[model samples]
Target: MSTTQSDRLRELLEPLVAAKDLDLEEIEVSRAGRRRMLRIVVDSEEGVELDACAEVSRAISEKLDESDAMGDEEYVLEVSSPGADRPLTEHRHYVRAVGRLVKLTLTDDAELIARILVVDEAGLDLEVPGVKGRKPTARRVEFADIAKARIEVEFNRKDQNEEDVTDEKEEEA
Candidate 1:
């Protein structure tokens, strides 16, 4: 609820999370009817697994149980990875979104939908989709110029596996 409480929780849990090679993305404390909900979002470049969440949950639960940081309030601890729609706020977020389609909103309020091609310390290289059989064009956006960015869900995403299979079929032919 308060910044102090959130900071305390971060102080208590960051090391435990980092020990498992995960980044503590967020700490949210909210009221759910009678009890408090402590939602902790953790992630790694390789992705978070169910087992990893369970492990982190167990560790954090034990630490909270031992410490009086929760102040006797009943709280539900939820450990999870940032979902597909999570905003791309960090450089690593952009790095992870490479090869995925994203909706980018500039600080000036301009918007563009492009596929990520590269990620560097300063900016990103994107392939802007073309219309009417036109070739896609490359564009670079400095990170400082972005207001918000999120991955666009693609149900039929063409990953490298499918392309490899197609190439194998062609070779067989």
Candidate 2:
């Protein structure tokens, strides 16, 4: 889709998303043969609920129906949550994934498995484990060369403490 159309779609969807108390992660419009597909990914601080997805889907469908954006083409509208394995695309996404393990593929044919240590204007600082004669290294990655990245979910949950919970609650408060 054209940039203008993409911007217009974002503008149109923002209010609907806000009304439903959800975050609009992305909107994709694609055509396959004679059919068009409109996919919307939405989320929230507490994660997305099925009712919220249904609500946003209904609102977006109504708006699209009224605007006739597809111009008589049959289109399928699908609304969903960015699943646990969702790709990290934005700066905020990277920031939120900090302290979690991630697999990143760089442009230089380097694949890294590391824990996200920090995110700053310069780039991401990842703690990569040692190999052979190399010590555990913290590498700074430019924001540009990250071809693909996603948070790695560990099967084992780390232990937490009362102090940790208290600190988190204080911060939220």
Candidate 3:
């Protein structure tokens, strides 16, 4: 996949996505069997809903159809939100994942599991989980030092589960 084509696609699609009040997270073109596959990932602070994805898909598909961007090749257009486990490469990804636990791999190959407390252009403020009954410590990690970062799924989150149960009970009452 050529970076030029991807950059062109980003240039073309970014405004369309921004007009709809969403961020164009990523655009990738890959060979799928005989045809090509264009995957567009869109996201928003409020989160991307199914309708939002469909709307972006429709708009992007129409734009692609009108333009000769795909070079007369039949391609599949798939627009979607970034998955929960998607790498936090962009600043907005970190902002969106605030309050969520994340596993970050540093450039030095050090791994840290921390809850995102803040995100700025330069770096992130994370609450590193304490061990042995100690309190969590606040740590700052610059984006340049982060090699990889992904949200960690907390399966047995008692606080969140209790809140959900309470909301359900209230709704039932």
Candidate 4:
């Protein structure tokens, strides 16, 4: 996608997303055979629902129709959440991944799979799952040491209820 086009779209549509309480994760304009395809990925701290996507899509589609951002081309609009496997990049992304398992590749060519315990500005407090029945251990992985980080998908997680990745808005009384 063109850099200017992406910037323009973000500039015009970000407020529309913010109005509905979502973070605009990414915007891509691509060719779909004879037409244009515009993909908008959005997310919120609580995660996005189908209705949220539909609402954002409608708002954005209407704005695009009124504006010339797409340059008079017929385009398809798709809005959705970042999938389960999306890479963790920004500080907000790591913060959102707290209490969730992630696969991290370090700058030293080592890989660690751990659940995020806490995320600060500099690094993450991770609970490295133990092997051979050993108890889990805490490990600190600095953001600088991370080469790549992606959320690990777990199906049939036995301890699913134990890790609540939601924001802690209420403290224990």
Candidate 5:
């Protein structure tokens, strides 16, 4: 899409998403065969749920139908939250990832995998896991030194199962 078109789309979408209490993370316009594909990525600190995405999609569709923003083109609109492994490119993204595992690459080309203990304007306090029965260590990384970062998906985190057990016990009380 041209710059003007992209800007116009953002202008049209920002308010709608904001009204729904979601941050518009990304907007991608692409060609899917002959039709255009409009992908909207929205997120929130509490996370975006499936129903929220559906609601946002419906609202976006209604607004577009009432406006000439899409220019009557045949386009598929998809609304979704960022994936589990999506790159952390913004401060807010890092803030949301606190207490989650992540893989970080430093500007000096060093790689580390750690759990985010805290996030501040300066950087992150990461809890680096230990190797071979050693204790986990804490490390501080400044934002300027982070070359790239991505959340590490943990399907079976030990703490997760423990939390579930605790929740079950609480419910039984």
Candidate 6:
């Protein structure tokens, strides 16, 4: 897609995303035969549910229908969540995944499973467990070296408690 189209799409979708309490992870426009495809990926703090996706899909469809953003051509509008395996694209994505385990492949073809300790202007600081007699090491990797990374979901009661506390704080604030 051209930069102009991408920018225009972002302008049109930002408000919709905020109104729906969703993060606009990506917007892709591609040609599929005679029709164009507009794919919108959204996510929420607790993960996006099917109903939420439907709602956003409906809203976006309406907006597109009303605005003629895709011109006179026919188009398909799809709204969905960026699944569990979605790459961490934005700094906010990394922030949201903090304290969660992630598998990242570095540029050197080395893979590491570590808890995201911190995210700063530089990049991600990860904590990887060490071998016997060796101290755990922390690596500060520039975002560029991170070829691929995804959160590792684990069923743990402690995580539930932490989420609850976070929810309470959000409510209070």
lDDT of 3: 0.91
Q: All models: lDDT?
A: 0.94, 0.83, 0.91, 0.92, 0.94, 0.84
Per-residue lDDT of model 2, residues 1-173, tens digit only: 55665577888888889788887889888986789888889877677889888988999889888885657879888999997777888887888778788889888878888888999976799999788978888889988988888887777756357569888999999
- Candidate 4, 1-173: lDDT as tens digits: 55689999999999999999999999999999999999999999999999989988999989998999999778889999999999998899999998889999999999999999999989999999999999999999899999999999988675644455332333432
lDDT tens per residue, model 5, 76-130:
9999999999899999999999889999999999999999999999999999999
Please provide TM-scores, in order, for all candidate models, with all chains considered together: 0.94, 0.72, 0.85, 0.88, 0.89, 0.73
Off by over 4 Å in 5: 1-4, 159-173
Model 3: per-residue lDDT, tens digit, 1-173?
A: 55688888898889999999999988989999999999999999999999999998999888888888788888999999988788888887898898899999999999999999998889999999999999999999999999999999887666767899999999999
Ten-residue stretch with the least lDDT total in model 3? 153-162
TM-score, prediction 5: 0.89
lDDT agreement of model 1 with the native? 0.94
Each candidate: RMSD to true structure? 1.9, 5.5, 3.4, 5.1, 2.8, 5.9
Q: Residue 110 of model 1: what lDDT?
A: 100
Question: What pairs collide in candidate 4?
Answer: none
Tell me how far the alpha carbon of residue 159 in candidate 1 is from the true structure, in angstroms, after superposition. Answer: 0.9
Model 1 Cα lDDT, one tens digit per residue, 32-90? 99999999999999999999999999999999999998998788899999998888989
